[model samples]
Target: MQLIESISKRHSPRSFDNKGIEQEKIELLIEAASWAPSAFNNQPWRFYVAEKNKNPEFYNNALNCLVDFNKSWAQTAPVLIITVVKTTYDHNNEANKFALHDLGLAIGNMMNQATVLNLFMHQMAGIKFDKFNKLLNLPQNMEPVSIIALGYLGKIEDLPAEIQKVENEKKRVRKPIEDILNYSPLK
Candidate 1:
């Protein structure tokens, strides 16, 4: 698929089919994320992939870590990918401010790749921080940034009325380039 077309078609899929994604496809999606650019090449992103049927306990635990609102629709996705990043890059460094941005780029790459592969992805931020930290056994230095739900998309009828309306509209709107870009500031 063309890059622009793929990006335009990529939307958060709230309803997913129960069918499992092929292992090869999952690997390809991760491989796409692996190549994203990082600040000074300080690649700090880590991913934890959990499948529902294979590990119900872990899946439920992770799902429970999401906010109640997210849990409603997220349960439909067959796979959940937890994205994390280590804080310290070296022994002397106490901070790395760009880790989140780097992770975002990686995730964007992953989503686009999924669209190219005829898969759907939903990146979510509504998570219960405390529960997630404890359930995932995350080290103090590693920060869990986001959760990505992956699977094949279900029919439009499966979505809530509001969401179904938006999907059916098929309109993609974004801030105009002029509004986002600036050349010079008034003195």
Candidate 2:
């Protein structure tokens, strides 16, 4: 079975070259994200970008917000983005349960765009949200969810021996369709 080239080539790579991404490419990625479907067209996704070349202070601060493990590798990337979700709907001012899912869709679009641009992206859940929240002075309704490191692919040898070994050894895998796709709920 063949998949879309961008979709098939999209895999999280920890090693990243320090080359800076072009501003136009970044804008295009964000534009692609904006095109994603949102519940009620709320468009609740907000991105905080820190580019090593354009915003070194913000880049360093965003890097510090990552957990130690992620920071170790993510520091090599030239671009860092924090994906924030608006917890409330814009029109109704009510809690939105689909905001997180909407954010995921937006990120999916961004990831595909990155792949199309021949850039690599690694999304990490391990972030120090407290520090990030304080750094951004985020309001109660806006919650930081994930941080992404984006850049060109780097030499695997650049990573720590343990990570390099894991990177070399691991292959992308998925559960069988029977295990994942079900018409009925599990008992």
Candidate 3:
């Protein structure tokens, strides 16, 4: 698929079919993420994935990290992923200012890959990161960035009433380039 096509198709879905995705597809998503460019080649992105159908324990562990509102919808997903970024460079233990940015790039790549495969990924920052850190036993250099709910598209009506209206009515909007672009730096 083309870049624009993938970008246009990509959406953070709130509804998901509770079916197991093939392992190959999961590997493809990770492989796509691995291709993202990073500063000094210090790729700091890490993904912790749990397939609900295959491993209920792992999936429940991930679900416990989400806020209640998110858990209500996210529990239906086949996969939940915890994304993390290494905040420091391994060499000299220097701060990596672009760590999060690099992680975002990796996620962007994965989103496009998912779109190409007719899958959906919904990412949220409403996670209790400390819970994830405690449960996953994260090293000092790593930190939870976001939680992603992933699966195939499901009936919008499957969502809770409050969210169903949003699914039915919401439209994707983008700010015009003119509104964001500035030729000169403003003081």
- Best model number under lDDT: 2
lDDT of 1 by residue, 1-187 (tens): 4559678888887889888889899999989999999877777798988899888888888889899767877888999988899787654567878888888888888988999888999888899988887876777888888788899987778776766675688665789989988899956
lDDT scores for all predictions? 0.84, 0.92, 0.90
TM-score of 2: 0.95
Scanning candidate 3 in windows of ten residues, the lowest lDDT window is 128-137
List where candidate 3 sits over 4 angstroms from the true fold. 1-3
lDDT of 2 at 5: 95
Candidate 2: residue 149 lDDT (0-100) = 97
**What is the RMSD, in Å, between candidate 3 and the native fold over all Cα?**
1.9
Task: Name the TM-score of candidate 1.
Answer: 0.88
Model 2 C-alpha lDDT per residue in residues 84-127, reported as the tens digit of each score: 99999999899999999999999999999999999988999998
Tens digit of per-residue lDDT, candidate 3, span 40-148:
8899999998888788898999999898889988987999988998999977689999999999999999999999999999999998777877867888888888999
Order of quality (lDDT): 2, 3, 1
Once superposed on the true structure, which residue ranges of model 1 sit more than 4 Å away at CA?
1-3, 159-172
- Cα error, candidate 1, residue 118 (Å): 0.8
Higher-scoring candidate on lDDT, 1 or 2 = 2
